[model samples]
Target: MSYSYTIQQHVYSFPDLKSVLAKASPFRTGDALSGLAAESNMERVAAQFVLSEIALKDFLNEAFIPYEEDEVTRLIMDTHDNVAFQEISGFTVGGLRNWLLSHEVDSQKLAKIAKALTPEMVAAVSKLMRNQDLISVAQKCEVITQFRNTIGKKGHLSVRLQPNHPTDDLRGVAASIVDGLLYGSGDAVIGINPVTDSVDIVGDQLKMMDEIRQRFDIPTQICVLCHLTTSLELLDKSPVDLVFQSIGGTEKTNASFGINLSMLQEAYEGTLQLNRGTLGNNLMYFETGQGSSLSANAHWGVDQQTCETRAYAVARHFNPLLVNSVVGFIGPEYLYDGKQITRAGLEDHFCGKLMGLPMGMDVCYTNHAEADQDDMDNLLTLLGVAGCNFIMGVPGSDDVMLNYQSTSFHDALYVRKVLNKKPAPEFETWLHNMGILDDTGNRLTIEPSHRLLKNL
Candidate 1:
């Protein structure tokens, strides 16, 4: 029998219902699970199964019975047991805070305790502690700060060439890349978000990016921000260095983008099967934003910022190479104007960092919104100080296709100069070798290069 589910306007079909059901069972809790359940007509009842809104046996009886015991279910049961152990350990919130402050409890112990406590319990403790103290503890948690090799090994920064054009024109894309490279960007990846959703168009763009990378010998990855399934389909036929998707806070919101955790996992695993990425490199790249959940009516009454952080939890599961919070992209309904946008950007950066994501900020705003480059500059400076992993390098911070202004290639240079940071090691070598940057990493005069000038 065929099973299909619709959430928002997207419909997901399960050709093999039992296999799909079993694969989804492990993630049958948390926002990711709830969001999937809510969108799935076949497993709509599974929405309540999260947090024991319904009993497991009852859920199985109402839903389909699994042939095998789910390891994820067993892990959940084990975590509950651990939570019970922590409750009786006699550490009050104040006591825990004091202990953390005094360094009497190390990060490992704190991490263990954090795992045992519910998210609410942690939030209550967080309320009583200083922000600096919380940040310090967060840094210590192993799960919160992952170092992936795609961008930098560790202690190095990166940037992506987001050369968005209105029509996915190869010349337009190359012009942006040339501009970005001349200004010393493209350490993370030279990725493009094709305006058209046509898989063929996206595939052609990916091929073009690959040809450029090979021709220039630039040490960077490439991505075309198509739907995850579309990207998966093109994996064998194209040079897809990373699988990209935009995920959000709620199931319905994610559905609006035609994404779910299962689909994300499929894309990630498919990339692995192809061995397309560098050895020991992560394959997934995701973009997220505040207000996306509320925009899609999937906020579940939660505040936009908290819901945004919950999206990080989903990102953490996949160990993506890059998880960027497009902080100001959603617009005024959730974050009204520049002040709100700046605050949300900083908060999202902090929250994503604490959750151990290779966090980047889009540092962007739409023309229709009450924002400008000055507002983005303020946030960009702060994020640089906060050790952001990457940022977008578009021409003049303007996306001709998306019609939004973001950080420009010059802006990236400014931030790196101010922070005394360099690009990824490989890309840095390429820049020096090309004479675009000198031995001291200073930008050389591009005017002498007629080829680049001619393009300009």
Candidate 2:
């Protein structure tokens, strides 16, 4: 399927799509209502346009256009006690889209409906939305902000120290943590991904991280991103601050990872049984991405992006501390290149935030993919603007075991500096007290003391 149009001597083809959005003007482009009907692929474009129009905030006096209400609208109205219709009487698809964009609608209310609304409806209204506008709605959306109280301390951004060693070598893991802490990273959680799935090995790694945290008197959490079953076995034997798992769009894909909602609840209950983290702090850390559904042959005709968003529904049910979309790690068959990866990253962050999860981006790429640091830099900036909760911090942006390049510890610092953000309050105070960061939470110029440099 394709839709083509010419504008200013440029011919643009909307591939895998079937409709073209017409520019808004005083004169009608066409009289047929069918002309405005959107195809699945046109949803993004239409949504973008509606968001852009709403950002203008000039639609108050204009009569909202009319369209038939479908199951999505009916469900939304019923769930919310018809407040949806009360807010926008005589609502049309176009009108509802505009109402969502307009300032008149409560962002929390909009988010509620947005989450309940079908993906097709969301795509239809949000097709033409600008990134900034998307960010605006996300800021007030309920789901995007729900986990805020439970994740980071003092409302500061957080970072995870994901030190992965090919052999699960405890010493190498210690070196990486030393590097991350010296650079003032891992304020979110000092987590490691063990190469071996053995419960004993992962249990040992968790003990190592706990030992380091206690040794340095650092105020931070610890986690080992082992399979859930391994994590479950180690619960009583180790100090697992947060249980880590990777979720996908389908039950089968999640099962392949040895997880499902029931297992997740079991982990949740088990974490509470151990009572490792601070009071009120959430104990689950989840990672997701597009294409996992298609990768597992369970997409069921839905686009990868949409399927990925639905996974957020599953995630929020558990009230996780961190839910990250490792946007570019899956490779090009799902997201073809840097541009595609960048767009999906932004979309995933936006959707996750809208759904009320503390979102982070593992801004990264594989060696064979059509992406680079420049692309990651671009995504890093966008996700920051979108109010991302935290991000991954490797020593030099390269994970030797995972064999991929992601944002480095320094990259997190740069974004914090550029955006005037700080790490979680408790960690920030620790850094300042230790002279690793200044009062403003900026990295200090103090030389690496022998205390930090000696072992390495």
Candidate 3:
């Protein structure tokens, strides 16, 4: 089917309501009513008008006419409830599109509901708009934002790489390594991590990554850098999956704190540009550190509450640009000084213990879970209930080495067992016979399998 217009670029360059109606169809008030009577039954046409939207919002910009939004909503509901339309056409996609083209839309409600758009939503919507493809430029952003909210469900398995690898090829190498190792076999989004604090380094990495993916035919993308959130320079360089930034450390006096704040500002500014810019999808991945000495007087380390406040502050400031984000919980043991803290403690703080404080942004648990298996289980279960969607850690040994070849399917199966409650039947039988499967045989009280721990 031929379309009247192709949104090859953005959606801003379209006609207005007065111009479109005048140019496309000469339907004045009396004339429109008369025409409706001539073409179809008045009742049917009126009912259809409530269900149909005008063709491509080209008419709105044409004559400087102000369309009242409430009218559009009332029309949508009316059409949806119309017995004739419902009985004749059921709420089909074509029916919805036709309704939207001829009717008005509540822009305010659309904005409120259009919060977290992601990449997957793109394909889904592209299918919806395949023929008409009439999504307004402004509406495209909102749709993408809602899409992000859906696909933003990530797991806590981050891929670590050497940021200061001293070569322009680092990004490509890192991308290939990550794609082969973590992303290749696992079902998680991979964050491209960097050690050095340079945008140029990140840019090179991204470039190399693109080249590697193109050359090797890998269908994967490394969400931008997981480093100190600084500068739009990195975002400006490439379309990213996410923008993971670090909140300054514990001590306010440390030099890293000063640098981190600077990075935070840059990241915030870049995120603003991204949200408003009709480019590809983007996100703000945030975290706070109590690594060594406290770098800031903020808290011992940036707790979830602090993370939520900061995230809200950024989201509020950026408005639409701050696509879905996560408040990373990087406790001391995972960073530099302290030994391993129990995963239960981290979950109580990060994943939340049924309080439901941080409701929106995804919560990413760091590789710190590798410190203990019971804690890993606790963190995983808590994350499941709390609705967190991202996870990070290295494969093979949890170090920054790309070792896909070395990944054990056995270990992968064990993780499946824990995550899906599909414990091996034989093992459960043994545990149950030994009185470990609970009285109902539905709950298995297996000691956190120490076998996996031994391998680690």
**lDDT (0 to 1) per candidate:** 0.64, 0.66, 0.32
* Cα lDDT tens digits for candidate 2, 1-456: 334454456454544221222222111112012133233334434433433333111222221111132222232223332343344445544565556567866655764554344333333334445566566665555432222123432235678888888888998988898878877788767888777789889888888888778877787778888888888888777877788899875566676676777888899898877766554557788999877866776544445665576577667667788889998888766666788787777777777766567778799888877889999998888777667788999989999999999999999888888888788766777787777888766767767564666654
Instruction: For candidate 3, give the lDDT.
Output: 0.32
RMSD to the hidden true structure, all candidates: 11.3, 8.2, 21.2
Clashes of each: 3, 18, 59
- lDDT-wise, the better of 1 and 3 is 1
Top candidate by lDDT: 2
Would you estimate the TM-scores of all the predictions?
0.73, 0.78, 0.40
Put down candidate 1 lDDT per residue, 251-296, tens digits, no spaces.
6667887877678778888887877555455777889887676667
Tens digits of per-residue lDDT for model 3, 1-456? 111222334222112222222122211122232221113233323322321333322211221211242221122223222233222233332344333334353333323322221111111122233222332312221222211222222222111222223233464445445322322122222345555557776666666655544453332334445454434656665655455544332223223444433455566566656652223333444443222122233322222222222222232222222222322234333221112222222322221111111222222334532334444444334433333332333343233332111122233333433444322232233334543334332333334452211222
What ranges in model 2 sit over 4 Å off? 1-97, 104-128, 140-155, 446-450, 453-456
Candidate 1: segments with Cα more than 4 A from true spot: 1-155, 447-456
